[model samples]
Target: MQPFVDGRYNMSKGRSAEGFDSLLVSITSNTGLTGWGEMAPLGSFYSAAFAAGARAGIVEIAPHLLGEDPRALTRINRLMDTIFRGHPYIKSALDMACSDLTARAAEVPLVTMLGGQENDMADLYKVVTHGSVEEMIANARRIITEGFHRLQVKVGGKVHDDIERVAAVAGSVPKGTVIFCDANAGWTTYQARQFVDATREIDYTLEQPCVSIDDCLSVRRSLNKPMVLDESVTSLEEMLDIHRKGAADGLTLKISRLGGVTKTRQIRDIAVDLGFMITVEDTGGAEVDTAAMAHLSLSTPEERRLHAIAFHQWVTVRTATNAPPVIGSRMGIPDGPGLGIDVDLALLGTPFFETSH
Candidate 1:
């Protein structure tokens, strides 16, 4: 609905200003309950996924779901995979819709449907978009002033400049505040080590410093700070391997990246069992996406849950009413049935196609 940027976050994946190309889906139950789902690609080049591909895949796979039970989430997911292998983002919306439908059918919230509520709210982290050292420090100051103790600083530029930007922001924030230097897989193994060495005096987290698993593992050996993985972590198998290698101390779990909440929570459970902290979120979407993320984060153990993002706020328009607000430094969640919010279909526009049996 809106093209927005939070500083250098748009640049991390070597993309231009990014826009939300979302596919909103609805699955209606025989009992008259409706569930909504959304899948929005960060950018055409950010990942292996793109909006056009997601829509085309949806068109191909959605008809197969017309006669199936909406509550059979695992079955539905498997059927989609059976019909269309790969392209996890394509099934993300359908999977989300199934979860919403199942929760509504049971008269419970999505979190309760997943299991039960393990938390009510989630700590929020603000992104410090790319800019000069001075500009970045100014942004960090304002973010900290807004009560955000956790910050994800965008780095991965020139090593010297990135070091300067990271050090400046780190020096400005108060002690005990969590600072994560996210390179978004822009750095090489050598660059990752250089940045880590330069910032050894500062206490901050490193995220996906290099693109490859081996590259990240190499970087991991050179530093004592906790490393968080994002781009390289797209599958359960990859997560298990990372755990086996002890490459990540924390993980950035995107619901869309992992397909949907089912696989996302599956990976989350694996992380918790292994004692790795997590940041439950999605690539990007409006209210529906945020609500789904909120419920998932809410159901995660507090200690293991690093923070959840209100991605809708990054969008210029509002898609759902009654979504949790980022007040102070926490995003509040409402305990209501299903997604617990109403979708603005008018803003979403008319559906491209529909079918019923």
Candidate 2:
């Protein structure tokens, strides 16, 4: 009762080495309005379980979406929300499916429909380079050549390791490059302060460095390093409150987590009005998801000069058997309607299980 895809890619072990057999998800609707999405089920923790749950949620709500206007994404989304409450991950799948389908149906890039004007440029950000000083330096060098002005490194879990990695990567970075750290809720505020102050030279933006949303607010209220909320600021109100409280100077807008593009734009406006910086980011899905995010990025404001979008580079491999949707790290939206992207249904995936249309 699910459409699953598995493929091979050389995943980076710690910026230098590579791992193989990476997997992804491709979701399609019966309307022939198909789309692709990724489920991060292999990242060493809940990624696997999380991805499975998302697939299950899609199965649970598929019947409700059958024959419905995928463009009326909110219709399916509302039903899924009310019918299957408390399954955020599953909601993510359904939301992404709708977005993917909607884009195809309208034949407009997701970014354009999401409200981006012409000539919108999106800058991509890669995962934090992990490993030795040499590896970190190498990875940073690679991304810089790829045209990413900002590099978001992972940290906040191991205080010393974070310091070491950021120190190494920071020094290795070329001049005028922006460096940001994503802790994934791995640090305490006190420790966060020390790390933030230390990495000040790296010009690192604090991203979920503290586990507690309140603590993040505490740090934002107290410090000047500019906290970026990735895990937090889930909804419109959350975005509003964070801005009102002056809690975060920036917010990372992830499509999969926040429902869909319609809602994504609301948060973007809120961020803009509050004078908080906003970057349309990824949920680390495959090319399609990256496309979705890119569309959002192109549609979002460039005043802050905030952009983090790169599709092919982020993934270890391609799932789309076709010429992987023509997209760029700074892909501009071609004039059209809706989330203009197609799912190569022929490459829906090698079947693990059959899902009848």
Candidate 3:
């Protein structure tokens, strides 16, 4: 378990966490090569996924993955999908390991396998977890001082209070700094309207104001600022649906939520073609997951890339060496093959579950 740096990550609907349960997986081939993957759900309430369920699913699926060619990414993912239904969160780690393994086999970075490196450094955004008006402003300013111009302000509390928080933070930041008021699916359509109307003059984007697509669309209709959808967008079909309905100006692409790099890359391509601004990130994890997020973000065109998170920076543990270090507000992908970081087995402690043919 990795403790959150801020002590607790408070979000909407009473979802708060002192730490997150991170699950790491490693796959070794006959030729003595290995690939790493990780998945860390925010909490049971935040999504349909939880740590125990992911671990259980992995245990059931791992034995079947033996002897499969890691380089055959599509085939491997298909096999996993065949064995398990609906639980994309469980399949994410295995899919990531396969991608890492494939990239290492080709002696290229994972970004190369995705498309190619399009940005030298992917811009990062800081999340201002739900807090008091003063606390949110202070946290936002602190991260801004660290050179992060983009901020995701966690709202979805009382409509009036959220409006005050967003307005105060926006007022505190420097001109041109981007502010995203992310509710994390915490508001009802009525409350979303109240918040939006109150902050109508503030320059910031609204994100996932409500829990459902229908509610989000209704809110978006009245929203003047750009609206970005998260949590609610769990699949390519949902993304396409959002695009079709023009429900969101942008969407957050969480690698684990969308299964893994394989399916994520597919959705990313389609999103780009459809012209959507994207924030590429994961549910949560240490170095391994951060590496995957960075590679994918780097491969995305910079103009459309809103920002990506350095999730490793949020946790207390170090899961890998040679992990990409955040220099100011931007992070560069590591210059090594595969996910570009070496997982520290020592830090990982011991295997929770193992299988062999």
Candidate 3 structure quality by residue, lDDT tens digits, 208-326:
99988889999999988999999888998999999889999898988889998999999998999899998889889989999999999999988889899999999898889988778
Top-scoring candidate (lDDT):
3
lDDT of each: 0.85, 0.61, 0.90
Candidate order by lDDT, highest to lowest? 3, 1, 2
| Residue lDDT tens for model 1, 132-209 | 788889999999898889999998878998999888998898988899899989988988889999899999889999
Pitting candidate 2 against candidate 3, the one with the higher TM-score is 3
Q: Flag regions of model 2 displaced more than 4 Å.
A: 1-49, 145-147, 321-329, 333-338, 350-357
What is every candidate's alpha-carbon RMSD to the true fold? 1.5, 4.8, 1.0
Global local distance difference test of model 1? 0.85
Q: How high is each candidate's TM-score? A: 0.96, 0.80, 0.98
Ranking, TM-score, top scorer first: 3, 1, 2
| Per-residue alpha-carbon lDDT of candidate 2 for residues 254-297, written as tens digits (9 for 90 to 100) | 76557655567677876777787888754455555555566666
* lDDT of predicted model 3: 0.90
